[model samples]
Target: MAWLVSTPSRKDDTGDRLFLEVAAEAARNERIRAIYLDVRAQAFANISRAFAGLMGSDAVSDEHRALAQAFMLIELGSVCARTLLNEPVQPASDRLIECLVGMPV
Candidate 1:
């Protein structure tokens, strides 16, 4: 007797790009990327209070939250530093990188 197939194998699927994979997963699942962005924003808005709440819940891992908080502060410092220098960091791309990769003062 022949056995029945339960799950599809790689041969049965079409390849997807990185962006497509992320978009498709976000579309089909509840845990979309947008939700993470929103939660991360809220976490920063009230970090002292939210940190306590975040510690109590499991929606976001504690380590990830800590990293995000540190990154947020770095971004804030980059913006403030540029404003003070009067260098007029006109192009937004550089500012974005500074926010993401620059160190906090």
Candidate 2:
């Protein structure tokens, strides 16, 4: 959250946006879509693993994975809110992170 808040907002050139553009021109089963899907999946798995590690998950179990997923959704929503409002979401986000991370793992 700190990193997210500190970074200046530019148009985030995320894979989801890129995938949308490519998807417009490509069939669902096309290799390009498959590649993007894999990339997106791997990216998410990687993030979940990272969070699990941070939260001291030895095996990245389902509970840990769900916790990580929740974090991702919150992170994405906070980013979207910040972007749309063109404002800083620091103390609120910081507090939220504290409440989340401080939870029993």
Candidate 3:
């Protein structure tokens, strides 16, 4: 089951903001980690969308590319956390990274 925490004060869609808030709170509860993992996976997907322009070899917006990197880092961190907890690696992790690498930055 997913835990719904109230949104913290923030002004960006960097994904790190949400992950940090979730991780900080989840650190106190093992049961909540799975929900955080799910959220992190979603964040990875959101970040992957930034490559839309780059896919066509068009100029990508700096904002989108930067946000994408932030999203990737967050996903990587979440993967490490899952590994530490002995949870199965999220299946989309490699695929998402592959997409990132395939896209033009």
Candidate 4:
């Protein structure tokens, strides 16, 4: 992964460089994988809640509904990627849950 990102053409791209660095670092640490798993779980939960809310709102237009569905699909991809990494499932932060659900923290 890092090798792909470190290609000559992409070597100067800060985002690619950062991604390579992070991937290398994560590869060396089990804790980073666990942290990523938690974050991805929270993201998936938030996206699911947002999708449900959008689907239930009568005020939302068909176009917006489609967009929301697309967003949910993207989040699902993230969830799948995290699952593939085989990170242990852990409880998500309360702050993340509250922010995602729009509930008082």
TM-scores across all candidates?
A: 0.30, 0.57, 0.36, 0.36
**What is candidate 4's TM-score against the reference?**
0.36
> Model 3, range 22-91, lDDT digits (tens) per residue?
7778888777887877876676555545454445534446655664665556455554445345344444
Candidate 1 stretches greater than 4 Å from native = 1-58, 87-105
RMSD of 2: 4.7
Model 1 pairs whose backbones collide: none
Model 4 residue 17 CA deviation in Å: 5.7
Highest lDDT model number: 2
> Between 2 and 4, whose TM-score is larger?
2
**lDDT of candidate 4 over 1-105, digit per residue (tens):** 222112212213355445445656777888986776676567555544554553465354444444444544433333433344533222322223323334221
Note the Cα lDDT for every prediction shown. 0.42, 0.59, 0.50, 0.43
> What would the per-residue lDDT of candidate 1 be over residues 12-54, giving only the tens digit for each residue?
1122233335545767777777874575578565543433343
Give me the runs in candidate 3 sitting further than 4 Å from their true place: 1-21, 57-105
Q: Would you give me the overall lDDT of model 1?
A: 0.42
Q: Which wins on TM-score, candidate 2 or candidate 3?
A: 2
TM-score of 2: 0.57
Q: Pick the candidate with the highest TM-score.
A: 2
Give the range of the ten consecutive residues with the poorest summed lDDT in model 4.
2-11
